[model samples]
Target: MAPPATQFELAQPPNDAISALAFSPDSPSRLLASSWDKNVYLYDTLRNSEEGAHGTLLRTFEHRAPVLDVCFGRDGNEAFSAGMDWQVRRIDLESGEQTTLSKHAAPVRRVVYSKEHSLLISASWDSTLHVHDPTNPSLGPLAIPLPGKPHAIAASPSKLVVAMTSRLVHIYDLSALSASLSSHPDQQQQQPPQPWQQRESSLKFLTRAVAAMPSDAGYATSSIEGRVAVEWFDASAESQARKYAFKCHRTAQPQTDGGGSTATTDVVYPVNALAFHPVHGSTFASGGGDATVALWDAEAKRRMKVYQKFADSVAALAFSPDGRYLAVGVCPGFETGMEDYSGEGRTKIFVRELGENEALPKGKGK
Candidate 1:
């Protein structure tokens, strides 16, 4: 069967490339997208469905530099954004009010909020992770130094995972980290977080993205070399044996060799974004330079479905909190010359309604 059609496309999207897409935690119809144009946009996914119109742009939040990542607060009334300006800002969705939360020495790559712990985590290229309390912004954020520059970060209910450029993966117990911070408020100036476990990344290429499984079973990590790894938090031999990596987002080009024989050269495309279904933990979608979004069944160890290719690279992706829709951000990746991005280079975000069969894999017992 053919894949579902795009429910609606954002109207007048950013002129620059989109960097991230996030769904509201409390409302599935609300989505937030960040772009290199230095703006974060909020869209109501259902605004035009019945009328056959474009998605409504509810609001736009301005930033000093290119926004890289965005995440909604638990209430879904606030959003946190990190960007190239070395700053993290919070936006009041209803009032359009903005507040600076923290600053970094280098560009921040990603920001995540943990509703369970009431903490906001920001990972920066400066090789540090900052934890802040949105409720108490005046207290200043706690900084934890890293071994290398961080590329991606994801958090589950109980664990926070960080993937760095040097092929390093650090897993932290969120409950423990929150308890330690709360117990030693006085030592906030000197204490650094103790990671629950640290291991060299299984993939050899630079990590591009990491996503925590909704069930808190394990996490998935994708690399620029067109590879993805599924890893479990369990240290037991049976669980560890299930951890593995596979290649995707690639193609083979056939070339004539000196012997008049054709040889195929493998070309690798970077895996840019990944999002697991909020309800079906075993199913996750990956978008990449290949310009396609493919859903995978990690437990079944196979590709369930591959969506049609977009006009350009798929830069970011997000599954709605209710698992009813998927938001895809498409744009010319960094390889595109910025000089050609003026008049006709605007990027777009597409929301696709997911059917029950698509949301749940066969025999998964979700």
Candidate 2:
């Protein structure tokens, strides 16, 4: 259990808007954040949680171009990054050696590794997924085509969820992906594995982020519009009927016309990030252009906690392995009619150590 509501801001944060944040499954104190500034940052969460503590910057991995996402490999000693440079690279956390795993046709947006399956998967704007088994580098990666460019991808114990443009969502079985790589070379070359299930997104807008439930029951997806939908992997009609979507990260603002009359307008901000608690499977969190982070209970459909506003739009979020800490990445959000964007001076990362009962579902929603 963590101290009550004890939170601190990390020092030496990314110089650009954060693309993603990930915590090491093997080490609760290890954290990683990828940024548009062509770098991936490593931080020590335990050091930053102390009283009067600013975050501890552990190491920096510089890339040729902006890194879109990062994730822990099989252990805390390794990491993988997806890049705007159209490359997927693996980093040795100890020696800081970077190795190019594969180059995609377009920018790579997300990378997720499934330790259970020994697979490293990267989703790219090229509308394809490059699957690699880090343990067996000689076999090479297998490329699987997609219906749309993937924007976000995540891995559960048994499944892979890829959320893409035009409201496309695809779920792939990790075991199948693993088997394809280890099978005879001719079979893999003749045919690539297909998604186990493909479904149109429940949300109408472009999908922004996706997170797989630790329980492997389903996943939650957020969109450019301020909305989130939860769906289970079970294809049964009864299970599918339980799927739901909700509105969040929006505010009602009074609009003033040049003529002087004022009217209330609903301002909807993009839901930029979503993270599920590892300890409490039914509880998850979302951050948005509203610069706020909210916790919700999926089973109960209730709002649990809403942290105070950050300095800017919340770009990325991750729950620590034990679910005791939540890391939030903040930067200026790109709004309608904006001509320029930069997170250089304003980028920040906030880590909150939750109380034992803070994120636990309290009961059914009212």
Candidate 3:
């Protein structure tokens, strides 16, 4: 049997459309959202303890324009936001202090940080990714060009990966990335004229190519094309090798639900946001436009359970560190399009546990 869809609405932002969202990685119950209303909100998931009391609103701040994305920085208490105004800003969750990093040439689409490196990455419509140090915004950004318009970006603290409109992913080594920036003229004064700075540097492309994941990976990408494919290149290799891999694994079925009948003929969905249990890396959840959240055996590429029937496209998904809960943001009836995002939106938290029937039909562990 499938897992029951247990949900709880967290909070409703006063925005007509919520375009970007994030839950605290360190504390999955805490949430931050940005919307067309030009405001940013922070909410706690467990605030509704008493019927008479509401969840705590850590803080809310108005932006100058429609904010595109909001994300946690290296620290859980600090958030970063980018938007239509072509600017990126950082907010301190505890003090509610906002700081503008720098103005982009185009609207900002995404902002991410690598806590281990104290680095922040932002992508913009201008087809550039700016690498910045969140602790200090006064420094210039190390601008990296993209093959096409970047729709989404993800990183693992030390590396940067981006999905571009051309169905490709650009992988840049953070160490090399930081080295490239150090060679910039602005950084020359601090480096004392290094010999490498005198040599002409060129734009280096990854030896390997990664495919774009359509929808279901999260709110940042679309899946109308059938599936989003990603390929990664190992920069450490002498030949710059590439590897083809599925970022999200979806079982295909024939058109069902009046769409089809064969399991082999249907398209595979893309993965939207991914949440690995803070304590258990092998367990994670993926939410998407299909209105279904799936629990996967991340390391083994196996499906453990499916949680379905969400009101709308999933905006965000997270797993608590204790591996006991799942949280998701849903925008009901809005999957048809984002134009009607204001209809009804809600955040739900589900209590999850390992199924007891792990008893396999033919296995020694069983």
Candidate 4:
């Protein structure tokens, strides 16, 4: 028999739109969520066992400005955040202490930790990337300059992928980055490292989110035009040919004109988030402004499942370490004509416990 299929809502969520959701590497129940409310909220997802509400608000780490992204450091007790204050912070979860690691010229967009490399990299809208050594504080971060401002970033076991504006994508070798940071511990003014591979984005519109595959074979990128492209890092013709893209998170609405003739309007929503399952690296999930979450089999080029629509746009997504739970962050989406916006009273977080084969790859696709 399969394990129980369950999904539950967390208690006492963030007061504003969630900018990012991250599950602790040490345990599946421990989660970290950074918000636009200038705080990072920690929760024990399994604190109260009986209620099935897989969370208890443990604490909140407030920042000087709205937090844009967050991720776990080497352990559960440590975390790092990127924020609108143009600073990257290191937070101690156990003591609720915060430390500023570095500052950027513009708002920081994303922060990611590479366990295998022991490096913490943060991307900012100022078109620069900062690489820090969490273990060695005396060493300052090695700054890397980019041609375009980064909108999303992800790290696999060996590679770092940065997606930026103007449809530019850069792939950097982690070993080179680690060595560069170690070589210049005290010199923050040292020259920036060049990208291992630089290529234009596959999608036509602006890039929205990027996620690296756990296996380190390749990475996936989503765009504002409701499309996702999967490509490899091998730089081989065979591997490059295997790369493909597909459309999702789109809907068509019927419109009526004065002549009583009805027409359909195709509405495209941005794919805001992308997450790969920790265990099954070939299978992944995509969340969108369409207010839905979808599971896809990259190897098969098939969609496994699309979860029920949430109350608002799906802004962020994450999978637990064991690949047992998938967390969804929902809030208001910033669209074309919106002059003002807020996630107040509309923000929510939901955790879905996966069944035995819920995210397995289903081979043989068209």
Best by lDDT: 4
**How would you encode candidate 1's per-residue C-alpha lDDT over 154-271 as one tens digit per residue?**
9998999999977999999988777665654675556687899898899998999999999999999999889999999988899999999999998789999889999999888899
- Write down the TM-score for model 4: 0.95
> Of the candidates numbered 1 and 4, which has the greater TM-score value?
4
When 2 and 4 are scored with TM-score, the better candidate is: 4
In order of appearance, the predictions have TM-scores of 0.94, 0.94, 0.72, 0.95
Which prediction has more favorable lDDT, 2 or 4?
A: 4
Cα lDDT tens digits for candidate 3, 1-366: 745334555544534456655667687567777766788888776676456334555678789998878889865788999999999898888887888887789999888776667778898989888878776566777776665777667665455667666455555666666666656556534532111111110112211111111211211222332232222233345413332233333446655456555446544444455555444444456676566776654334456667755765565665554444565655543435556455333533233333433211122223
The stretch of ten residues in a row with the least summed lDDT in candidate 2 is 46-55
Q: What would the per-residue lDDT of candidate 2 be over residues 198-306, giving only the tens digit for each residue?
A: 9999999999989989999999999988999999999999999999999999999999999999999889999999999998899999999999999999987778888
What is each predicted model's overall lDDT from 0 to 1?
A: 0.88, 0.90, 0.58, 0.92
Clashing pairs in 4: 45-54
In angstroms, give how far residue 59 of model 3 lies from its true place: 2.0
Q: How many backbone clashes does candidate 1 have?
A: 0
Weakest ten-residue segment in model 4 by summed lDDT? 184-193
Candidate 3 local accuracy as lDDT? Answer: 0.58
Name the lDDT of candidate 1. Answer: 0.88
Best TM-score among the predictions, by candidate number: 4
